[model samples]
Target: MSELKLNAIDFISFAVAGNTFKLKANLIGPNDQFHSVNLDIAPDEIKNKTIGEIEKLALQALRSA
Candidate 1:
């Protein structure tokens, strides 16, 4: 098997709830495994974060999906 790594994140949807945001995404991993993840984060945490940073956070959530 190939090494596990984050390949891509297809952000399918998003919505705001209270002080946080819920992002629905398809986390693409090694070997084309797709994991659906609902990542909830405070806007303050990612408002200034780069796309790469946000993707990293989403990928982390995918691990527990």
Candidate 2:
């Protein structure tokens, strides 16, 4: 099996709360400050979705957050 390496310059995390799933993107500011954005996507929204579809939604959410 091949290991998948993501060239992510920022931080990301996945979490679940009850029936909703949360995706967060963390950033470091120029002054070494920390900030984060959270996107809560319902399970049904991404259910049965393709990898590409999910990725697209995730990126969109990140941008909006």
Candidate 3:
């Protein structure tokens, strides 16, 4: 399969009760189309993570989808 590329990330919302943040991941598909994925993540999940690391995660999610 062709590699998926991470395009951008947008903040959707935060659930204070659950302590989770919602994010919209924008990716470039293998066919050059844009794909959007919504991810719910805890703040700790991204703490101290570099941009490259986060990009890798996004790409992995795209591939799985």
Candidate 4:
């Protein structure tokens, strides 16, 4: 499958109780269409992760959608 291109990542909010993060991802689909997706991330999920790694995760999710 073709990879989705990540255009931007925006911070939406944080849940203090669960320590979860809400992010908005702006991506370019494989067909060159633009898309915006919301993602819920746990602390463990992002620990020591690079921006590229996060982008890969978003791309994977978008491809499966």
Candidate 5:
């Protein structure tokens, strides 16, 4: 098995959303904040993502705060 280095995530910033704190991203997608996760996958088992898929998911996840 192998580990895949996905994308880099940056903490954009936090804001006061009403009585709670909220975050924002510097790029595309829903801009939701999620805890970091490391997945274990075989080299061949890793999905070959297309440019659009990378953009839609990887970049989106990376840009998310």
Candidate 6:
């Protein structure tokens, strides 16, 4: 066999609560165990607000930036 060796790897795993989750980022899972995960970005909660309110939110971000 060649002398090359595996020195590092990238992995991910996660656990969840009622509506929240704890993601173990950059984690190396056990060799015999299988872990699967999916990523999602929750939609913003601003949909029900008025357009003026949304405009206000935009300005707020510009001010912060």
Best by TM-score: 4
Residues 1-65 of candidate 5 have per-residue lDDT tens digits of 01223344344233334332222212322344333422222333234634344334444454352
Distance from true position, residue 24, model 3, in Å?
0.4
TM-score of 2: 0.37
Q: Estimate every model's Cα lDDT from 0 to 1.
A: 0.60, 0.48, 0.73, 0.77, 0.34, 0.31
Count of backbone collisions within predicted model 2: 0
**Candidate 1 RMSD to the correct structure:** 3.5
Q: Give the CA lDDT, 0 to 100, for residue 15 in model 2.
A: 53
What residue pairs are clashing in model 5? none
For model 3, the stretches where C-alpha displacement exceeds 4 angstroms are none
Better of 3 and 6 by TM-score: 3
How much lDDT does candidate 5 score?
0.34
Write the number of the candidate with greater lDDT, choosing between 1 and 2: 1
Residue 18 of model 3: what lDDT? Answer: 85
lDDT of 6 by residue, 1-65 (tens): 11222222233223334332222212123453332222221234423545444334333433354
Instruction: Judge candidate 3 against the unseen true structure and give its global Cα lDDT, from 0 to 1.
Output: 0.73
What are the per-model C-alpha RMSD values against the true structure?
A: 3.5, 8.7, 2.3, 2.4, 14.7, 17.2
TM-score of each: 0.58, 0.37, 0.68, 0.69, 0.24, 0.31
Model 1 spans with C-alpha error above 4 angstroms:
1-17
lDDT of 6 at 9: 24
Native-to-model Cα distance after best TM-score fit, residue 4 in candidate 6, in Å:
61
Tell me which of candidates 3 and 4 scores higher on lDDT. Answer: 4
Better of 2 and 5 by lDDT: 2
Cα lDDT of candidate 6 equals 0.31
* Between candidates 1 and 6, the lDDT winner: 1
